[model samples]
Target: MIPNSGIAITIDIGDEHFIHAPKKKEVADRLLFNALNQTYGYNTVDYAAPIFNSQEKKNGGIVLKFKNAETGLYSYEKLNGFEIAGEDKVFYPAKAKIVGRKDVFVISDDVPNPVAVRYAWRNWVVGTLYNAMLLPTSSFRTDNWDDAIKAKK
Candidate 1:
């Protein structure tokens, strides 16, 4: 599980022993350094991916604010994997951009009165949002309401 605090890593040893991979030590070392730098407060390291902070409705879209994006927020190429939903509880793909240091503006022509937003909410999602530190953003949803994606089917 991904914790709110601490660091994480992905490892694959195939059919070999757990620590047999040549890169295992390297990966573990990196993870330890990140934990010490980011979690232990060794000069503000942006270790984990950005998580949802807050959001507000703007003129035609929603402005999403983040906390762990101290350096700034970013996206790979153009923004993707964002969706906006209205009171009808239906969601549509949205156009999003980093507006400032830690804010992102998401808009969807299909969702005029958007009441909720979600990012990388799919099981097979390829996350695009990132912080200035180059870490990817975690999957998040704005509300606890029923999932619009599930309702579609």
Candidate 2:
């Protein structure tokens, strides 16, 4: 697991096509800029993407808060890629939105008593959540409880 310290560097390699090959230099430049500004402290920079900070239960839904989101949050397109679950431990696709600055509210009709939430949990997820700096949020799960498969063993 990568620690939340300011020493980490993240880079997005993008797609595998001729059209994207030309963009590699741009991506590398951006990554270098982030590293210089964030890790080396050359200047004040928004280095890391916003990360999950906390959550709260509210009227049958879950409100998620984030750190490293001082500039606020957004999505490249419509918000998606969130899931919620109840005590049954069955996760279902959820509706999510940015509320206030760094808070995301998630809810699912299938999970009325949600106890946990996950974002971009799929193997090949196309996540959209990002900070105002346009850095994407990483996949995250709110619960550490053992899976049902483990419990059944």
Candidate 3:
């Protein structure tokens, strides 16, 4: 940070007097901005992308669909943490997929059969949802799964 041109508000606390000035970015920020500019296809990656559903109806309510602003789901290896729910609202973690362009199908693995599925249910989870490029997938919750917050709380 630099001092304001000519006159400005100045104050002295305990250690030293402070002068208002034009804000300047730190080196780390400059480095990141530079990296983003130089990095290959940076726009294609989203760290915390948002997920929105399409109003157009499809196969059925089961046809829960959304768009990944990015090209595709990132897969350092394989994406995971998909889960399912029945009418009872029981959520059991299951397998998932990136079909076609943006649709992700969360299959009922443990439950064998299911009605609805949720992805990345945990808050502040490290990583799970992402395009094949490893960009973080949008955070979401499938069901108010019974006891969803109860157990965690």
Off by over 4 Å in 2: 1-23, 148-153
lDDT of 1 by residue, 1-153 (tens): 565246442222112334344556644664765777756777555465577889999988999998778788876588888889988888788899989668999998888899899887775555677778666676789978864653352
- Best lDDT among the predictions, by candidate number: 2
What are the TM-scores, per candidate, against the unseen true structure? Answer: 0.76, 0.79, 0.51
Per-residue lDDT tens digits for candidate 2, residues 1-153, read 553234322223344343343455656665766777756877776677788999999978999999879889988677888888889888888899898968899998887799899887765566688889877788888998677211121
- Higher-ranked by lDDT: 2 or 3: 2
Candidate 3: tens digits of C-alpha lDDT, residues 1-153:
443211111110111222322222332343443355445436533332336463222232233466543465545446576666656566766666556656666655345545666665654333455544333554566555556421111
User: Ranking under TM-score, best-scoring first?
Assistant: 2, 1, 3
**TM-score quality measure for candidate 2:** 0.79
Which pairs in model 3 have colliding backbones? Answer: 73-131, 73-132, 74-130, 74-131, 74-132, 74-133, 74-134, 75-132, 129-137
Q: Which stretches of candidate 3 lie over 4 Å from their true place?
A: 1-64, 132-134, 145-153
Pairs in steric clash, model 2: none
Worst lDDT run of 10 residues, candidate 3, spans 5-14
Cα lDDT of model 2 overall? 0.75
Candidate 2: count of backbone clashes, pairs at least 3 residues apart or interchain: 0
- Looking at candidate 2, the ten consecutive residues that score lowest on lDDT are 4-13
lDDT assessment of candidate 1: 0.74
